[model samples]
Target: MLPPDARMLASQNIVIILCGNKKDLDADREVTFLEASRFAQENELMFLETSALTGENVEEAFVQCARKILNKIESGELDPERMGSGIQYGDAALRQLRSPRRAQPQGTQECGC
Candidate 1:
């Protein structure tokens, strides 16, 4: 059974969970960090937070989540054959070969004796 708030937003295999942390603002006016974390855990969603003031765990949170996703991909938990998960080759040399080539220097012959 899917979580109450879990809705299929896209046909592609993608799930996004939004959580708000940092309750130090007014305490009574904000959702507690633990509450947000628990909600994510209960729904099997990635949980992360950052303090814009102190920048605590901002980079770490992103890196950690990325590592987790990569690990899943490597372990075959996430299928690489999917549209966005497929391997991408960005070598410039391959791209150049596809385009029209310019005239080569006369001295530089293709045959290597």
Candidate 2:
């Protein structure tokens, strides 16, 4: 359960709740789609299931969350510059640092040496 203040922020902002690792175990341990959806509805969260092993819906989950955040920004429900806001690009510089970098081959010259 979330704290009262955190829950209030979550309610005010768009929240996406995802359950991962569905491909590893039997169906018993897996949370069902209906159950997840119900939980999301009850708590006002967006729910999705994904398999990290299979890379299923991984990108979709992020995209959906981004869209929801964008909607909140557009609707004036959230301030992009606000601290603790869930906007993805709130710290754009951190995103640049988090991006994957291409490793250059050792002793390989860029001039076709």
Candidate 3:
């Protein structure tokens, strides 16, 4: 069962992926692929078993998630302009974190304190 916070995030239509790490360690697995897959489906999450050591499915997971978010934005389901949407796009997003650098006066040099 998902915790309350996770459930709340899901309710907000957050793009969540449930990743099973250490996929290469089959003998040490506590949960089967079917079980994880089923749980993800029930919880409306994207699922993947990834082996970090092998670098397997790591990039694919991110790519798939980006695709899902892009599709949602394109379908009018996710509005990046909406406050608390958690989406930042274009130069506007960059501009938010950037401020104009003040120029020092001409011939002014700072001595190391």
Candidate 4:
């Protein structure tokens, strides 16, 4: 039973990464690599076992995530104008998309001009 927000986010076409951190202490791990990998495969998510202390696979995980995102961007699968789906926007691009019409003052019977 996923939360409402979780379901909503899942509905959006976005990348999901299942990263198991603290791989330095694998002996104490409850979730096995096979299980995590299989789960990721089933859910269409990227999986990476990372270790912050040893710095193993940390950079690679980031690079992999970035690559997936860039691929989506290049393919036009992720639209930046869709709004609020974790996409970064530029200020100039936003300004260009805004309505150019100016607002009229309220309660003015008619325009003097």
Model 3 agreement with the true structure over 5-74: per-residue lDDT tens digits = 8646543667889999999999999999999999999878899999999999999899889878766776
lDDT, candidate 1, 6-111, per-residue tens = 3443323233444343523545546667777787777667776755566666666667665664555555555544665433335755343333345679887652
Choose the strongest candidate by TM-score.
Answer: 3
Worst 10 residues of 2 by lDDT: 94-103
The local lDDT score (0 to 100) that residue 68 gets in candidate 3 is 83
* Clashes, model 2: 0
Q: Quick one: ranking by lDDT, best first?
A: 3, 4, 2, 1
Tell how far residue 113 is off in model 4, in angstroms.
57
Error of 3 at 18 (Å): 0.4
lDDT (0-100) at residue 39 of candidate 3?
Answer: 93
Q: Where does model 2 exceed 4 Å of error?
A: 1-5, 9-11, 23-28, 83-113
Ranking by TM-score: 3, 4, 2, 1
lDDT of 2 by residue, 5-90 (tens): 75566546656555545644546565666877787677777777777778887777888886676556656677656666655464
Can you give the TM-score per candidate against the true fold?
0.53, 0.60, 0.74, 0.67
Clashing pairs in 4: none
The runs of at least 3 residues in candidate 3 whose Cα sits more than 4 Å from the true structure, single-residue gaps closed, are 7-11, 90-113
TM-score of 1: 0.53
